[model samples]
Target: MDSLSLIELFLSALRFAAPLILAAVAGLYSERSGVIQIALEGFMLFGAFVGATSAHILGDGVAGLFMASGFGMIVGMFYGVLVLKLKADQIVAGTAINMLAWGGIPVVSKMLFDVTSNTPALEASERLPNWVPIVVALTVVAVTYVLIQKTSFGLWLTVAGEKPEALRAAGVSPAGVRWIALMISGGVAALGGALLSISLASSYTRNMTAGRGFMALAALILGKWKPIPACIACLLFGVCEVAQLKLQGVMIPGFGVVPVQLVQILPYAITMFLLAGVVGESRAPAKLGQS
Candidate 1:
């Protein structure tokens, strides 16, 4: 490819990777704090729906983004409460949250806008600043890295995940740390979701995340739960998606046109392959998934 083509490809990769970066960083926080972050998908979905709907209602995309973040945190709080207070299994609770978002968004959309599947499309001017989401996502990755490596909270988070009793001996509540981590995770993941509707696409579609949440989870694991490495992993996955989009239709000698559907599976397929091959070598927190 030409230099310009390479630049274009790189830009597209960044665009596609933005949401994954956000979600993966969010997962990093929750998982590093000893919480299984399976509910990222639900968090993203809720964010997308709430962001789009709020933007339409308020006529301000930035406001919508904040709204999305707030609501996402609420959902996160709900999830945290269930797991921390009620002692629900984290994975099961997370799965239920995902299912609830998948079904509940449509119901709310239909009631509010008379459309059961998607929110009304936002005008270009009504969407958030185009470069904002990507910048925010990258910033989140940086902030997460700093928070994990440079600060006291980072130590708390590490202890919460690997040695909760240590944190308790330090006079901190592991449960409190985890609850805050999950809330932050929800807010960050929600921004990724908002980007999907307000920056990348013009409207919210049912299940518009299309398993990007799961892909982000894979990236998190592949990066061994570090902020910078996870961001790098997300960028790699984004490149695969961009390739899928760019290679939509082409003829190969004697093979006919390339199947677009197969191309669409590229990122997901790569994610699964990496997870199966690499995750065994990645070390998770010793106390991860412990209540």
Candidate 2:
């Protein structure tokens, strides 16, 4: 590839990877605090809808972005209350949230916009620039790494996840820690959603997240929940996506064009391979899913 093509490829990879990196880092916070936040998909979807709606109404991308994060925190807190305080099944609660968000968006969109699935398309000036999401993702990754690896709060999180009873004996409320972690997780996931709407697509569509949240979960597992590794894994997945998009029309001597289905399978295949011990065993928090 020429230098210009190579640069374009790298930029595309960064754009594709930005949301995944944000979601994975967010997942890290919740999972490390002993909560299995499988509902990140739902949170992201909600955030995207909220961001798009707010941006369309207010004509300010930053306001929409913050609103999305706020909505995510609210939803996350609800999830935490259901799972942690009421002792509901974490998996069921998460799945329910995803179902609710995925279904609710279309209804809301139709009611508000008189359209089937999305708000109006945003102008370029009204959307967050692509570079903003990339910078935010990189900052989040760096900050999360430092927080988890070099701070007292990080130690508390580890202890709470590993041994809640021990944390209680030490006068820390493990439930509180988990709640905070889940809120942060939700907020970050929402940020990813906002990035998708405002930076990636500039429009809201039902199910626009398109399983990126689940992909983030896969990256988290593949990276063994470490910040740097998770970032790397997300970048790899992003590259796969970028390649799929870029090669859509390109023809080679032996292969006329690669099948889109095959490209779509790349990330999942990598996930399976990583889980099969190619990247080493993944260890969840000791008390993950425990009430």
Candidate 3:
């Protein structure tokens, strides 16, 4: 490839990976606090819808970004209530939330925009600059690393996941720590969603996130739940996605011309390999789902 082509590819990779980076960090915070957060997809989907709608209405991309994070916290708190207060199964609650996002978002879109499709197309004035997501993702990673490695709350977060009784003895409520973690996680992941709608694309389309949220979760596991490594993994996945796009019509010796649909599976297939322990084994926190 020419230098210009290589630069374009690099930028495309960054755009693809940025949202996953934030989502993986979101998982890091919640899972580290002993709460499993499979509802990340739902939270992100909601954020995308809200972000697009708000940006279109206000004609201000920054305002939409803030509103997206705010609503995401609300959804996170709702998930907390289900799995924490009501003792719902974490996996079940998460699945329900994902389904809820898929079905409910379109309904809301219909009511607000009179279309069971996506929100209205955003004008240039309503869209964020492409570089915005790349910067936001890196900044979030840096802040999260500092908070997790250099703070008292980080200690409580560790204790909550490893030994809740110990945290209780220290007079710090493990549940409280998890609640704060989940809320922060929801907001951060919502920013990822907002980035997808406002920065990566012009507006929110139904299922616009595709499987990026779950892919982010996979990246988290591949990185063994660490922040910087997880972001790196997200970027790697992004590179593969861009490669797939570029390879869509290329000829393969045995495979012939690559089908677009087939090429798109590269990222998800990698996710499955990671999940199946093909990449390596990963251990979760001891009390990950314990209330």
Candidate 4:
């Protein structure tokens, strides 16, 4: 309604978009390197739980963030071994990873804190500054752009996904390239997940991600897998989320009041529309998901 309100709304949108941007870029790294990463949701959930639990134990949020990244990488490496070494179906492996996170976090939480869902609330000093995640997300975007467009490793990644045999002929192991890519992906997505607990919320709650990982996938598709465009798509989805929050309970001249459930579906609804419109035109790497 006013300039101040608009600015606040924009800030809120940025905050909401940070995790999506992080995870979308992370997914880009994996998919662009010929590894499908449907397990982003799982990676993020693990990070959230680990980040919260570690921070609570160590009394330090930064330490928790590192722990989250470490665990995420471990899981990512496991995923790589399953898909690349054992030749497991990438989609199936990723789905299993997601299911693992859904079930595992609670079990671990119960073991550690005697709770099966959430960790204790963190103090302000124990949480990340609000600016930290926003800055980190943007930095990752710039770095990803450089990594993909201005580096030899980037070239190798492209070849690994589009023509793995070419990379192998060049004396590079395409599997190695993919393994590294997935590791980076997991670490980045873990940062996004840590931000959920240490920056956005004070504690890690069960299923708090609430499909943001899938939304990030949609953003990745909408952006055509490019870093800058994916960030823009994330912002767009963030706008949808903020609109959902802002428009709920508002009176309409002819519609009375907006339904909260419908408002809540704004981001997801937009994602479905964008995916449907682009799926036919979008093209993935030639060798993506190939063993």
Report how far off residue 77 is in candidate 3 (Å): 0.3
lDDT tens digits, residues 1-291, model 4? 899999988888888899889999989999999888899999899888889888888999999999998988998899988998899999999999999999989998899889998999998889988787888889999999999999999999889999999899999999999999999989889888988988889999999888988899888988888999999999998788888887989999999999998888888888889888975588888888885
For TM-score, the strongest prediction is: 1
Q: Give the CA lDDT, 0 to 100, for residue 237 in model 4.
A: 82
User: What pairs collide in candidate 3?
Assistant: none
Q: Please give the ranking of all candidate structures by TM-score, highest first, separated by commas.
A: 1, 4, 3, 2
Encode model 3's per-residue lDDT on 1-291: one tens digit a residue.
799988988888988899899999998888999888898899899889999999999999999999999999998888899988999999899889899999999999999999977999999999999889989999999998888889999889888998999999999999999999989989999999999999899999999998888889889988888899899999999899889877989998997998998888888888887788744578888898886
Q: Model 1: per-residue lDDT, tens digit, 98-120?
A: 99999899998999999899999
Off by over 4 Å in 1: none
Q: Candidate 2 lDDT, tens digit per residue, 30-134?
A: 888888878989999989999988988899899898999999999999999899889999989999999999888888888999996888999877898778888
The residue pairs that clash in candidate 4, if any, are none
Worst 10 residues of 2 by lDDT: 272-281
How badly does each model clash, as a count of residue pairs?
0, 0, 0, 0
Off by over 4 Å in 2: 2-8
Local distance difference test values of all predictions, in order: 0.90, 0.88, 0.90, 0.90
* TM-score winner between candidates 1 and 4: 1
Model 4 misplaced regions, further than 4 Å: 1-4
- The better candidate by TM-score, 2 or 4, is 4
Look at candidate 2 and give me any clashing residue pairs. Answer: none
